[model samples]
Target: MQICVIGCGYVGLVTAVCFAEMGNSVTCIDSNVERISMLQEGRSPIFEPGIEVLLSSNIRGGRLCFSATLDDGALRGAEVVFIAVGTPSAEDGSADISQILSVANELAHKLTQPAIVVCKSTAPVGTACRVQNILDQHCASLQRIGLHRVVSNPEFLKEGAALNDFMRPDRIVIGTDDNQAQQVMHQLYEPFVRNHDRILFMSRRAAEMTKYAANAFLATKISFINEMAAFCDEFAVDVEQVRKGIGADQRIGHHFIYAGCGYGGSCFPKDIRAILHMAGEHNRRMPILEAVEARNQEQKTWPFRALQDQLGEDLSGLTVTIWGLSFKPGTDDIRDAPSRTLIESLLIAGAQIKAFDPIAADNIKRCYPHAVKTGQLQLVDEPYDALQGADALVLVTEWKQFRQPNFSLMRSLMRNPLLLDGRNQYEPALVEREGFVYVGVGRPSTQPVAAALRAVV
Candidate 1:
């Protein structure tokens, strides 16, 4: 199959590379000339693991290429064109699908032959229909009506394991009323789902809704556990124990059950907002989802509030170390990350921050240039180096490298042996046994009884 993937962002890049790896000819197109140039040089603009290797291999095999525009001979003889552009959340919480629309309009003019246009981006419901309408109208004006087909094929790739997710998708949802489009999509995705027929045929709207609902449900689970963690904290109970207790039931699996600072990334936060906006447009009230969003927003502030509670409302002259900056590990994406919320709060309180992440350090440095220039924030090269002379440490993202550390060295490096486990990555008793005061989500620290009583009194 000759495929053209519009947008060299994470999804588009991964999709193009993986398809090319499967022996399909793929040309990835992006408007960003620099990004396309990087891809053409066998370098991935995103921080996904193993993508550049696959991209280089495919390019070497003459199966994959990159271009800056669709008119640059990339769209010639393309059987399937994927609209994988970013649909970021707008100010009103709706998905800003201007990118998708723009691509559709461009394809109307550029595509000289009939092709299946796949909506690979997570857009609002009816987005495929809108794109179809746009293409249909423009094609009619050009006296080539019904020359193209549009399919909703939203991506379900995880950030860290996108390659694996694309190579072995659990299920492939193809949304189109056109039989030809459905068959073509199935043939394209047939290699990924060989064990069984996992290709689900559905209407375009349902497919789009499925993407939002899937992300929204996962976000709801995260917010639900965070809410439970808060309740457990009120009773001095460990949310970990509660999580395990509930997870034992077969009905309730252990996925997304771990209580953390919050859920953040390109998908969950933005998709939830888009769905809520969709509901609002139809005069529908999703109170539960509203609460879920509210809880998540509050959850992101947990580490900041905990720091203030430990070191007083005014954090002036305090030196705090942060363990992670990316929203989660395996990717350098900090969109709506809890570390940003914590950093913002800490900087406002006049606290100096030393942050360390194996891959996200440079990105964080870019985000806080003023603080970095003023010496209020330091993006360190080493994890322990960030702890040097720090008053307390906050574990924001649970990176694999941060799972265990030389606690004795950490104790000696810090000005105060205080720890806030934002991801509940550490055991309270074990950390306290290492001679440090440890506070975790819904976990009580081993504070002195006298100090607790005095505080209560």
Candidate 2:
């Protein structure tokens, strides 16, 4: 199958490259000339694990191509056209469908033959119908071509592991009414669903709602665990133990239950807001999702407040080291990262930050240029470099490097021997044994209690 994926953002590029890898000729279209040029030279515009390898191989084999104009490439002979443009959040928290609409209008003008237009972007319900209407109007204006089918096929690819998710999806949802469109989409995705026929066929509206619902449910789980962590803090109970107790049950089944500094990324924050806005449009109040959004905002400040309680109000000359910058590991995306919130709050209280990440440092510097200029936000090359001359350490993202470091070196480099474990990455007793003040989310330092318990035993 020949495919054209519009909008070479994260989703579009990954979808196009992965499809090309699966023996399909793919042409990825983007308006950005520089980005398309980079892809033409066999370089990925974004950083995703195993993507460059796949992209380079496909380009070498003449399977994948890039272009600024869609009309000249796969759009002419494409069997499946994927609209993978971005639908960012609007002022009212609704998804701004302007980009998707623009692509739909463009596709309507260029596509002369019959093509299955698939919505691979996260959009509101009834968007496919709107696209169909746009295409219908375009065809009526031209008075030369017949109608085509528009289908909703939302993607569920995570940032870091997008290639794997695309190649081996857990399930593929195809929402279309036309039998011909359904058959074409099913055949296109057959290679991926060979292990099991996990292709779910449903109404267009249901498929759109499913994408939002999945993200909303996952966001709810994260916010629920974060609120529970707060309760555990008030009662002096360990949330880790609480998580273990509940996660042991097959019903609960731990996945997003780990308590940390809320949830932040490209998807969760935007999708939750978009759903809330959609509910409001229907004059319905989503009280649960509203609370979930509020809780996540507050959770981002947990580490800042913890540090204030330990270090007092005046942190005028304190040098604090932040271990992670990206929202999660394996990618350099800092869209709504918790580390950004923490850094902003700490800087307002007059504390300098020495932050390090494997990939996100350069991007973080772009956001906080003043911090770079004023010598306040120092982007260190290595994790230990951030610890040098630091007063305390705060672990934000659970990167592999920060999981187990030389505690002895950490103790020696810091002005105060304090460790704030944001993701509960270290054992309380282990850090305490190294003669450092260890603070976890819901667990108190075990040094004092461990000695007494050991004597009793």
Candidate 3:
């Protein structure tokens, strides 16, 4: 299939690369010249694991290409066009899909022949219909009505594992009332779902709603577990045990049940907000989702609150080490990350900070230029470098490298060996036995080494 994917961001770029790897000729378009140049040189502007290699291989294999703009008839001879632009949240929590609309209008004028336009970006209901109307109106002006077809094919790719997710999707959703459009979209995706007939045909609106519902539910699970963790804290119970007890049930098999700082990336927060805005527009209230959103906002501050509990309300004269800066472990995306909330709070409280992330340190440095310039916040090159003279170490994003370390070395490096495990990745008793004070999300804080050993016995 001849594919044209616009907006070479995370989703679009991954889709183009994966499709090209599957032997389809793909042309990815982006407005930024620098980004297009980088892609043309076989370099990925984004940081997704295993994507750069696939992208380079596909480019060398003559199956993938990049363009800076839609000029020179970029959509010509394209069997399928994917609109994968960003739909950021407006002030009122509604999705600002002006970019999608603008691309639709551009296609209406620039597309030489009528083709299937897939809305790969998640949007509100009727967005695909709106694009269809635009294309149809343009065709009517040219005396070729009903020549184009639009499909709502929302992508379900995660950030770090995007290549795998795209190559082996759990289900392929094609939203179009037109049988021809559905067939073409399915045929385009047939290679990925060859082992099973995983194509789910539905209305365009239903497809859009499915993506929102899926992410919202995952976010709800995270918030629900965090709430349970908080409740267990009040009762001196370990949320880990409670999580295990509930997760053992076949129905609630643990996916997002681990209590953590919060979930922050491109999808969960934005999708939840869009759902709430949609409910409000229809005069409906979603109290459960509202609480989920509220709980997550408060959860992002868990590290700071825990620090306050240990170091008191005023964090002045403190040196804190942060192990992770990205939103999650596998990617360099820091949008709305919990680390931001903690760093901001610590900055205001006059605490000196040292943070280290294997991939996201540069991005975090850009976000806090003044602090770096003034030496209040130091983005260290290594994990242990950040621990020198540190008062407390907070493990935020649970990267693989931070899993096992020389505890004795860490104990010697820091002035005070306070360990706050944000993701509950550590056994408190074991960490306590390492001669450090251990604090976990919902696990009991372990006492000194001798006391912890006695308690374990």
Better of 1 and 2 by TM-score: 1
TM-score of each: 0.97, 0.96, 0.97
Candidate 1 residue-wise lDDT, 1-457, digit = tens: 9999999988999999999999999999999999988888998888999988998999999999998977779889999999999999999999999999999989988999899999999998889999999999989898889999999999999999999999998888888989899889989999988888888999999999999889989999999999999887666678999999999988999999999899998899998899899999999989989999999999999998898888888898999999999999999988888899999998998999999998888888999899999999999999999999999999999999888999999999999999999999898888999989898988765454345556678
Q: Candidate 1: lDDT of 101?
A: 95
Best by TM-score: 1
Q: What is the lDDT of residue 22 in candidate 1?
A: 92
Q: What is the alpha-carbon lDDT of model 1 when measured against the actual structure?
A: 0.91
Q: Per-residue alpha-carbon lDDT of model 2 for 1-457, expressed as tens digits?
A: 9999998988999999988988999999999999999999988888788888988999999999999987675587888899999898898889999999999988888888888899999999999999998998998887844468899999998999898898889889989888999899999999998988989999999999999999999999999999998887665678999999999999888889999988899899999999999998999999999999999999899889878878887877899999999999888889899999999998888898999999999999999899899998899998987898888899999999888899998888888988899998898878989988888886755553565456668
| Candidate 3 per-residue C-alpha lDDT over 36-91 given as tens digits, one digit per residue, 9 for 90 to 100 | 99999999998999999999999999999999888866787998999999998999
Error of 1 at 17 (Å): 0.7
* Top model number, lDDT: 3
> What lDDT does the true structure give each of the candidates?
0.91, 0.89, 0.92
Q: Which residue pairs overlap in candidate 3's backbone?
A: none
RMSD of each: 1.8, 2.9, 2.8
Residue-pair clashes per prediction, in order, are 0, 0, 0
The reply for model 1, stretches above 4 Å from the true place, is: 447-457
